[model samples]
Target: MYESFYGFTSKPFQLNPDPSFYYGSRGHRRAMAYLEYGLHQSEGFIVITGDVGAGKTTLVRSLLQRLDSSKVVAAHLVSTQIDADDILRLVAAAFGLPAKNVEKADLLLQLETFLVKLTAAGKRALLIVDEAQNLTPRAVEELRMLSNFQLEDHALLQSFLVGQPEFRQTMQSEHMQQLRQRVIASYHLGPLDLAETRAYVEHRLGCVGWKGDPRIEASAFDVIHAASGGIPRRINTLCDRVLLAGFLSEKHGLTASDVDNVVTEMREESGPERSVTPINAMPGLDSSALARLMADPAAARRLAEVAAGYQASRLEARVEQLEKVICALLGLGANTTDGADQDKERRHAG
Candidate 1:
């Protein structure tokens, strides 16, 4: 909404993980290096774990964007607490193979056949499992077994596991010894520092063609870094709202005070106190008016209706985003095709 006001070509602070806007902060660079090292080794598990909004997914997307499709075929899956059997099926489905209602043995056979075919075609198969923290021990074991698929001395498939910080602890457990032994590389992604935070914001802004029209004050960067705890997603949320607040107030430059106000409003919106209010307790409502509304059954019904509508709107938006992610994971969208083709197009356009 504020794009035109700021002369941006697109929304700079979107929460979605877009590879084009990826910023290689210090920690991200090391993580990427580990991932590249894992790819070079090409026959074991590569694990990356981070906090909820530390940009793990974006890092993976950036790696995928740079891959040479002629040499590698990649499949991505987002875990949802699936069991061991379901994990196999999900992996099969990720590679565009039919998996529904298939027996475990059949699913494994199909996946193996597919991987072998890719290997024959001179391409290695890569499986990226995001949100791996939700996977059951049995499910993870199934993944390890898949990694054991080999033609002679060559491994047919490689796996990259990405998840929240707890997944690292999960990997350290006694039950995960076999999986641990197979891990060739692992990196813990940390949040950006203050300087990286400033760079990150500027990087995203620059991607959308920002030319300093809506200038962000130096103090504002500190305020954002503190409020967002240097987490990329949190910073995106805070900055997006701050920009919107600036646009609403017709201010071309953002100050720390603007960020503080937006943060307060966000907290108030999410706070329990905002969820319900008695008619008499509502601010700016006179005692007599409150009494009149409390006495009128129609007024109470209208208020309930309004509240229900608001809740429904919020649910609808959440559902929409979930649907988009599901479609992307399933490769059901045109934009979700093989990364190689998209990368080629992106480079050609550039």
Candidate 2:
């Protein structure tokens, strides 16, 4: 709705990861370099860990977008908490190989055959496992086993493991020593700094043709960066709503006050406090325990992941309601556009 009002060619702050919006902050640049280095080596695993919403998937997508199809065939798999057996099937399916009902032995053979064919064609196979934290040790071990595929002294497959930060703990455990030994490169993507946050917002807007209309004040970016903690996805979420507020008020510019009001309204409506009474009490989260949980990195990442999943489930419902309201407002706007419709139609009919 705001896109039309703002004369934007696209929704600049969409949640979906788009390579076109990839901003090269210092950390992201380093992470990208590590991924590229892994590509050049063409073997083993490359591990990338980041906090939730720190833009790992966006980084992966950007890499995929730049890949030369003639040299690399990449398969992306978003994992859940599956086991060793299921992980094999998921990998097979990701590469477009039939994985149904086949025994583990056949599955391994099939995958090896496919990889060998790709190697023969002068293209190496790249498997990108996203949400790697959800994998069981055995599942991750199975992934490591796949890296053993070789022909004529050349490895047939390479893997990239991308996940929330806790996955680093899992990867460093005793049982994972072999996998760790195989890692050629690894990087942790950190959130953007305040300065980069400001640039990121403008960069996204510029991508969709923003030309100073509905100008965001310098102070507004301060509010945004603080609210988002310099996380890209959170920044996108808040900026999207801030722009909506501007569009609703028909304002030519947005200032810190405008941003603050939207942030306040959003907290009241959607913050975890809305369910805290039940979440903290009925669900058995005492104050001390809650604090401890938040302090623990693994627990915090799990909570955030679960909360994000719950929020995503509600997105479709929200989109439907928003669309209905927008359509209604559009009909009303059409009627009121020029004094309840032009009289030219009636004159022409007469």
Tell me, by TM-score, which candidate is best: 2
Candidate 1 structure, TM-score to reference: 0.76
Q: Model 1 Cα displacement at 312 (Å)?
A: 28
Q: What residue pairs clash in candidate 1, if any at all? A: none
Error of 1 at 54 (Å): 0.9
Model 2: weakest 10-residue lDDT segment is 275-284
Q: For this target, which candidate reaches the highest lDDT against the unseen true structure?
A: 2
**RMSD of candidates 1 onward, in order:** 19.0, 16.4
Q: Residue 156 in model 1: shift from native, Å?
A: 1.1
Badly placed stretches (over 4 Å) of model 2 are 272-350
Against the unseen true structure, what C-alpha lDDT does each candidate score? 0.77, 0.77
- lDDT by residue for model 1 (1-350), tens: 89998899999989889999999998899999988888888799999999888899999999999999999899999999888968988899899999999998888899889999998898989999999999988999999999999998999988999999888888888999999999988889976666687899999999999999788877676556645656799789888989999999999999766886886687568664332212222222233432333233344333332322223235434323333433333336565334434544664587
C-alpha TM-score for every candidate:
0.76, 0.77
lDDT of 2: 0.77
> Candidate 2: lDDT of 218?
71
